[model samples]
Target: MSEEEFRDFDEELSEGDPEEGEGEVEVVEQELTKELAGECLSLLSRTGNGLSHAYVRLDLKNRKLTDIAAIQSFVHVRYVDVSGNYLEDISPLGELPQLLTLHADNNRLATINLKELQYLQVASFAQNKLTTTEGLSQPMLDRLNLSSNQITELSGLTETQLPCLTSLDLHGNKLTSTIGIHLPSLQKLYLASNTLTKLEGLEGLRQLTTLHVRENQITTLDGFAPSMEGLQYLNLRGNAVEVLSELTKLQCLPFLRGLVLAECPLCELDEYRVEVLILLRGLERLDKDEYTEDERADAEELSKQRAEEEAPENETVEHT
Candidate 1:
């Protein structure tokens, strides 16, 4: 696919169905029947109190079904897997009061709004046609994965208040920037294979440890902020960062230990590794390669000599 693979339509979000293929074999839509539920429902977890029992899990994957109106009756189910289906709307699942985990990947879902599932913990809607993540408001959600979707922008994320969220994976989307996200409690964030040009609006993410913006259009570290104290890993491979001196801005990241810049323009320089090490002595690894003890000592010695040489320049300027 081309670089501008994921197309965007201004700022407006559209939930319309994707264009169908020519002469595509149509599969008849099927509803959730009691007999199918009986075959799919193998009580994975249960709790009993007198004559009452709570069902904890159900696997309804690859059922080729369209409607799942029967799950609302199974109120005790905590985990549900309805992936690989022809589901276009999953609003019926919003009626599930005790739902904890929901896997609805590889479906034809265009828009998802689980309607503030209070007890929902983990949700994955990967490989779907979701164009926006606007209405998914879960207070207790910890991990969310929306990979391989056509999501153009991240709206209503901060306004939703995901207090317990730690990991968010939006790999392979159409996002053009990181300006809309402002999650402070998030730790692991994946924005790989997007259309991002620069990184900003994420400086307040103090707890973030891993950030994957690889295969994007990022060309500079001018937006890097020192307030991001907890980030230790940043992947910037396959970007357009060319100026070797631009890496000097990376010194603001005091806690950064691993950085990936393998396919960038600066990686072609002969003194690339030594120059990067000289700038940021704290980095322990670079582009899938760990720094050896000998390389560290050499960098330290060169750094001292380089500082000494620049000392006379400062002294001359002072005298002037």
Candidate 2:
């Protein structure tokens, strides 16, 4: 063969080879260029809603999204929902600094690094394969739903750090004990369907309004302290609380309104009922039932006034 023809054939063979580093570099460059074009398109598509307002919702349910590198350009995202995806790691989402809400339930995420999400408010990691709860550093977070996971310990949550958290749902886990943890602002705490045998860590939560301690092996209420003065509702139903004697200790909570002792082994309501009534003089409800005549009358009067104000003028005239 001629020398020129031999050189052309060699060139063709090199271009056809798959293991060439030059070809790999060209492919990577194409991918990066396409990604940049997509980012430009995304930016152009966004309306002038606000400066700190960028929402990206990705529902890759049951899809094989192995790498989320495309989301690197969405640094201004405020909300992201990648629930039900096959994501094993969520490190890609760390690039978004302005994220507020994240819904990543029913995935294979074992751990999350949420240190960059400083503005995140609501986070749901339910039904994931998480064994340990860590790396959540958002100070303004209000709601957290981590139910149906394999979390065995509640040691990561301390009162001094998570002061802004109001609601926490840790149901269907393996938490056996809670010690040295205080949730001061927690209003509703759901620890049902867990392995907790005692309520020890809840003594210092003065602002706890609703506590669902049902379906546990709690036999006594001795862990409760009088400092829980703002407790309004208590649900010890489905427990082994045979005697209702320690309930008098809760009398200091003058705002205690509702008490759920159903399914307990209590056969008599003799003096305990009267004691509770006398102690919590402001008790207006119990087990989803209204209070006595006076409280019900007051509530009805307020409801009637609100109804009159909300009624349409034509409806009022027709009624008159």
Candidate lDDT scores, in order, read 0.80, 0.62
**Number of clashing pairs, model 2?**
0
Global local distance difference test of model 2: 0.62
TM-score of each: 0.88, 0.69
Instruction: Pull out the clashing pairs in model 1.
Output: none
Best by lDDT: 1
Model 2 residue runs over 4 Å out of place are 1-58, 61-66, 159-161, 267-282, 294-320
Q: Which candidate has the top score in TM-score?
A: 1
Please identify model 1 stretches exceeding 4 Å from their true place.
1-25, 48-54
Model 1, 98: alpha-carbon shift in Å?
A: 2.1
Q: Give one digit per residue, the lDDT tens place, for model 1 in 1-320.
A: 12121111112122322334445658797999867876776665555333666556888998987999887777777789998888988888888888899999888888885787878999999888988877777899999988888989887677357878888998888999787777788988888888988888888787888888888898888777888877788788888999888888888888888878888898998778887898888887888677899888888898899899999999999999
TM-score of 2: 0.69
Q: Report the C-alpha lDDT of model 2 over 132-198, residue by residue, as the tens digit.
A: 7666656778888887778888765665556688888777777787664567888777777677777
Backbone clash count for every predicted candidate, in the order shown: 0, 0
Score residue 43 of candidate 2 by CA lDDT: 25
